[model samples]
Target chain A: MKKKHIYIYSPSSAVRDKAAYRRGIQRLQALGHEVEVDEAALSTYQRFAGDDRTRVAALSRAAASRADVALISRGGYGLTRILDAIPCKAIAKAIERGTEFVGLSDFTALQCALFAKTGAVSWSGPALGEDFGAEDGPDEIMEACFDDLLQGQGEGTGWRVPPREAEMLAGFRGLHGATLWGGNLCVLTSLLGTPYFPAVDKGVLFLEDVNEHPYRIERMLDQLRHAGVLARQKAVLLGHFTGTRKLPHDRGFDMRTVADRLRGLIKAPVLTGLPFGHVPTKVLLPVGAKVEVAADGRDVFMVWGHRHAPGHRAH
Target chain B: MKKKHIYIYSPSSAVRDKAAYRRGIQRLQALGHEVEVDEAALSTYQRFAGDDRTRVAALSRAAASRADVALISRGGYGLTRILDAIPCKAIAKAIERGTEFVGLSDFTALQCALFAKTGAVSWSGPALGEDFGAEDGPDEIMEACFDDLLQGQGEGTGWRVPPREAEMLAGFRGLHGATLWGGNLCVLTSLLGTPYFPAVDKGVLFLEDVNEHPYRIERMLDQLRHAGVLARQKAVLLGHFTGTRKLPHDRGFDMRTVADRLRGLIKAPVLTGLPFGHVPTKVLLPVGAKVEVAADGRDVFMVWGHRHAPGHRAH
Candidate 1:
């Protein structure tokens, strides 16, 4: 793969683990990529990467970096606070120039807002510290996917549904031309009534989250359903919902129940096990891109094609 | 005070503490009120009082009970799932007949939906197990507030703002004829883009929550702000945002900061220390009712007046 220039910035929580962040930058260099770090990328104030203005300025720098890709340091909580001030036009222009914006979690705020404001696509993938700098070394699959994104050779990704749910998702086969839109469920749900929420009709919405209880997940999905979001979707994809603490009082209630209940509520086909979330073996997904979905028994695949070619302008 | 009929129903989480639930009924009975418990009030299906249809039936029975006030067994998580099937007309008719619906947390969904669908008022106050059945005994303030509701004498409620914030809130005085709405921050936020969210312009929005970190609180408030809800409000009254687990990374980003940052974001007066939320000394406030706000030094009073007389139809 050809070497790529990666721009790193912090638009969310502060970098509490500087060593891990440093390791991530080193790992990117080891992979033969030129990395540029934003001046305020390591800045801190309270629980944020910096105050709102600093983070917004950091985002502005990322958009104007002219690098091949702009990646987030980590995802915690900040982007939503700076949504109003995000340079959406510059971001969309950067995407137009083939600079793919990549991050997840809090970055969902930026992805959705950019799409809502300018209809530009962004990547929902790894963060620097959390993904590339994992203590056990970066997972091979994730690194390969990131490389594929850089090389523009990735057409799509696929995963096998859990055995029990395989048959339940058989009907989710063969969907084409549906706009793909969604990211961290909590962040996406927070944009519900705000102008930042994307207005994509019949989109293939995929969602994942970390450290959220099943009940809260169900509540957020119910909110989307109540807001008529789910009804307008062609299909609903569930990625990994990780790091939840279940209480004894929850009894048999969990993510499975939440998904089952959601399936019963909405008419769209709901499929699970997308292998994209806060897990090590995750795949890169394109937010606000048109895609085709297919399933062979339990193996589900979403093909966004090689839409990253310069001036392609899939949107 | 004249004896009033109190209908107890389980529209949300199941009664996990049977003893506490029983004590609540006993306390209400001992207080000289005719207490009627819905047949499915104690029924359980996983974490809910019953399954969706069962809970919906329980809500129907509560609305039909014609009791002076209908109270919830407890709040955990349930109501959002059944929002579509909730009997809005029946609830409105019940309120028209002087049956005031009451509860908090999950019940906020129903309150907002009721107001949006039929312009009916519900009470944002105590639940049976947590409030009336406390091991130490029901809080006198909560009991008095409940009594005030039962007797049609709760014209208003007041509390003293924190001393440091007193001067910051002097301008919050004299807000007249604004709708008093909002309950359980998380639940209320989940209804944002949904039809369930009330369209109350120039309202006084009061919010409270439990187990949410200050970041989550700020994110939710920012959502309301971005959605234009806060700007349209006459004022924002923040009750106790309780049960947070602060991390070392917070570094002083707490509720005070959340309030201060919010005050800077919008023009409406943002006042804190309303005696409500998941606390022992919570005061009842009528959701969807018109209210007047006044401040004297550090004290804030929200006056809803007694608008429950027959055929009054304040809406």
Candidate 2:
């Protein structure tokens, strides 16, 4: 694959680990990709990467750079502050020029805003310091999957979970051409009732989060279900949910119990074991792309682009 | 005040402190109010006061009982799960028959749902175990405020904050007849984009929470602001926000900073020092009531029902 120009910028929280960020940039360069760092990428203003104006300006500049990809430096808690001021048109124009913007966690605000405002797709996988800058380097699966996505060679991706759970996904066997949407659950729920909320119809919605307890997760899923967002979806995919600490009040309920309750409440099939979210070995997924999803025994496949025609059926 | 029958029930979390709950009921009985406890109020069902069906049955029975006041036994995390099964019409009919449903915290979901579905007014105040059953007994201020509201004598309630913050509320001096709405901030945000969200125009929206850090609080406030709820409000009243642990990453930006930032973003005056929420010394507030509010120097007053004209202004 040809070397791609990767533009790195910070649109969320302040980066406290300058050395790790530097190491991430070096790793990208070593991988034969040209890197361009935004002026405010390393600047700190309070708890943010920069003040609202600086973050907005940095995002606008990165959007107009037209690089092969715009990768976020890190995720924290800042993007929602400057979401209204983001230059959505410029980002859409950048997408038109083949620039793929990518990040997860707090970046979900930006990606959802872009999709809501312009119907443009963004990547929901990996980050600079969080993924690529790992002490032992990026996880092999993440690195290979990201590279394949960037080179436009990954027509489809598949993952296998424990065979015991195969029956849970059997209901989604022939689903096809469902628009895959959603990111961090908390971020997505934050945008509800706002203009920045995406109104995807009959889509395959995927969600994952970190550090949130099972009750909190159930509350968010309840919110989406109450909002009629889940009822309109063709399928609901569950990814990784890590870093949750069990509270004494939780009784016997956990993430699995939350997932089971959600499956019982919503019309769409809820299937687990998606290789995505705040984990090291995450899959790179297109946020607003139309994709075909099918579950066969313990294996699930999600394919986009030329791999399958729109609404293609699987026997 | 004449003797009024008060029906106590649990529509959310199970009663972990059985003695405390019993003590609360005894206290109400000692106050000369006829107290009737629901059959399932003490029954436990895995973190809930009872199963979903049991909770819904209790709520429906409470509403149909036509008791003068339907007070929730406690607040935890069950109401949201049974919102659809709630008999809003029966609850509204009970209200018409002089029943006043009351509770806070998780009860916000039930209150908001009732208001949205039937325009029914509920109480945003104390609960059994948390307030009346306190080790030292019910707080004097809470008992007094609740008595005033229950006897129809609380046409107006007044409270004082630090004189230094009086100027912050000065903008609301001329505002009158603003529909007083809102409960727990998280619960209110959870109902966003749902049919159960009350559309109160030009209202006085109040919010309070417990255990949420400033950033989370700010995000929810931002969601409301972005959804156009704040801009349309006559004033935004803030109650207690306590029990949040300061993390090393806060960098000195706390709840005060969040309130300050919010004050600058929306057009409505953001006033603090409301005697409500999870705190012990709180005033009983009439949810969905149209009230006249004004800031008089260091003192703030809220008056409802026959005490003021629709657009009464403060001199």
Error of 1 at A289 (Å): 1.1
Candidate 1 lDDT score relative to the true structure: 0.91
The candidates score, on chain A by TM-score, as follows 0.97, 0.95
Task: Estimate the Cα RMSD of every predicted model relative to the unseen true structure.
Answer: 2.2, 4.6
Worst 10 residues of 1 chain B by lDDT: B306-315
Among these predictions, the greatest lDDT belongs to: 1
Candidate 2 per-residue lDDT over residues B1-315, each given as its tens digit:
667788999999889988888899889999999999999988777678888999999999998777877899899888888878888999987877677788999999988899989888888989988899998889999988788766756676777766657777565555677798898999889989988889999898989999998899999999998999898998888999988778876777788888888978988888788988889999888788889876677788888863223333121
Q: Tell me each candidate's TM-score.
A: 0.97, 0.95
lDDT of 1 by residue, B8-105 (tens): 99999989899999999999999999999999999999988889899999989998888999999998899998898999999999899888898999
In order, the Cα lDDT scores of the candidates are 0.91, 0.85
lDDT of 1 at A19: 82
The residue-level lDDT of candidate 2 at A166 comes to: 73
